[model samples]
Target: MDPHGYEHLTPAEAIAYQNQLRQKINICELTTPIKTIAGADISFDKNSDILYAGIVVFRYPDMQVITTATAISHTSFPYISGLLAFREVPALFNAWNNLYSKPDILVLDGQGIAHERRMGIATHFGLLTGVPTIGSAKSRLYGKYIEPADKLFAESPMYDNNELVGIALRSKPRCKPIYISPGHNINMQQSVDVIKNCIRGYRIPEPTRQAHLLVNKIRIENGDNRTKQMGLFD
Candidate 1:
């Protein structure tokens, strides 16, 4: 992995590489119904080059906060489109390794199956960790959306050159839609249902929303410049 561009792995072996990544995480099946889901997000101080990674765990369906972990690290690589997982996954894992409770499914704040090779940051992370994950991005990475007028779940199908990749869903009535896709060991509809259940009267799900804010919160607390209240949409 060169830590830049899509040159880390070839498109031919990307799927197999992803499968290899998923094999590392111990996918323990729960005897009880799923009760918790977590989200992870990261922010970078472009000036100082410090990375702030945050994780928020919440009770499933109910979306109650359980725990939070945030870690700071140096940037591993410059931001690139396809190879994004390598840049932030290290810091995210740092935060995740410190958690007492592990989540059943991770609601990632990035794209999943909606990628060109079905391996965006969310999918790459899920595949690497073997944790079932979903992408809940604020913008459509690569898709055409109908942009529904009335429903909170105003959905539009995501496509990559005629391939149906994922769904763009508006979890709230007026708020922007979240780009959703199955990351690993999960179907698209289940991903959508799980994300919807995690909503706690906000635009993004509680876990992700909390993690998003917490990422900047830690930066601000540490006197890092990544906490500039810039526009959410980029």
Candidate 2:
């Protein structure tokens, strides 16, 4: 494999690659207006070989799905903690190539700078694609915090060793909070605000939720060899 390619890296190499790129991740406030947002996700078949990736672009605030792209490919990597980008991002790259319009920001259904390794899928993908990205995950990866209020828009800081890494966000009343983190070219607060704007009465942000549904639909239409929920990254 090329030095930066994910094709043939061992688990150790993958971890090292993440650490190497971690320094390049930029978590800064979004300085411009966003009129479009893209949500991305990937799913795998049994034995973790065949992978499906999807991207859903939506008009900001309105959350209207405007464009969608999907791709399927075989992966050689296994499921490993802190190194999921290797298993998922290649297929996403394929789908990204098919997009007719470029979104202003990408909201992914996985951890971003909130990761234990500081290089989750969203962060890694952002660095690779040169796109601003945010991570809005359904569960915690590495952080601790007091629970945010259950009401919609409630949120609290998530910290790793006293360093604030992300937010535990309540997107809807009575639903479990989802975690939000900056991936690249955007800061934590900006990420939170973007997610809040994309929500449409659902637990997950609308862009990511729509992308999740699209990938699952593709998986089902193609054939589900396994009953497991799809891996969360794009």
Candidate 3:
């Protein structure tokens, strides 16, 4: 299957494809020591079809910036809530290809198994690239959960029926909780632990928050005049 061939897919076709790939998802604990971690995000203006995808790698445990990659591409897929991977992953794949230093794990700014079909952008990307990924979404895409406590690191289990899907975590005091789920090559508990390590006085974890800022910065700097790709390293 051509991983980038999602552009021409109908909504039904996309759903079918997601169903097909989801069976391959492996949920387990990460066995390797995590020396590096990365975050991925997408940004676009509502009035434009251009998408800015950014990936920021950081030295894990310490959270120092390592390298960043950004890609600008045009997506033809319409905004479908459950099928967002079809619209976003192509550009993110381009950015991933240009990354010089791939991290040990990735924190995607979207859902993982916490989706209706259990095939969110993070899971899709992990299936495509065979990387360990976790979704740290700002909003709950799927699952039912009680509100977490107001203190930092407080969490509540999120469930779809009787199945555990994700967690609603309070990363900062008085802020809304962030949703976390394992994408691939990781488990729910490990996902929460990794996200906890990434938070630093912010509602969103540092990995994904930094990636969001990077993509939006690129979008604002480039404007809507042209589509291009760029990368930065530190």
lDDT of 3 by residue, 17-113 (tens): 9999999999998999999999999999867889999999999899999999999999899889999899999999999999987899999988999
Ten contiguous residues minimizing lDDT sum, candidate 3: 225-234
> Best by lDDT, which number?
3
Q: Which candidate is the best by TM-score?
A: 3
Q: Write the per-residue lDDT of candidate 2 for residues 29-69, one digit (tens) a residue.
A: 77888999999998776665888889999888788889999
Off by over 4 Å in 2: 1-4, 224-234
**How many residue pairs collide in each prediction?**
2, 1, 0
Quote the lDDT for 233 in model 3: 28
User: What TM-score, computed on C-alpha atoms, does each candidate reach?
Assistant: 0.81, 0.92, 0.94
**Candidate 1 — worst ten consecutive residues by lDDT sum?**
23-32
TM-score attained by model 2:
0.92
Cα lDDT, model 2, residue 52: 88
Model 1 misplacement above 4 A: 1-32, 226-234
Sorted by TM-score (best first), the order is 3, 2, 1
lDDT of 3 at 180: 97
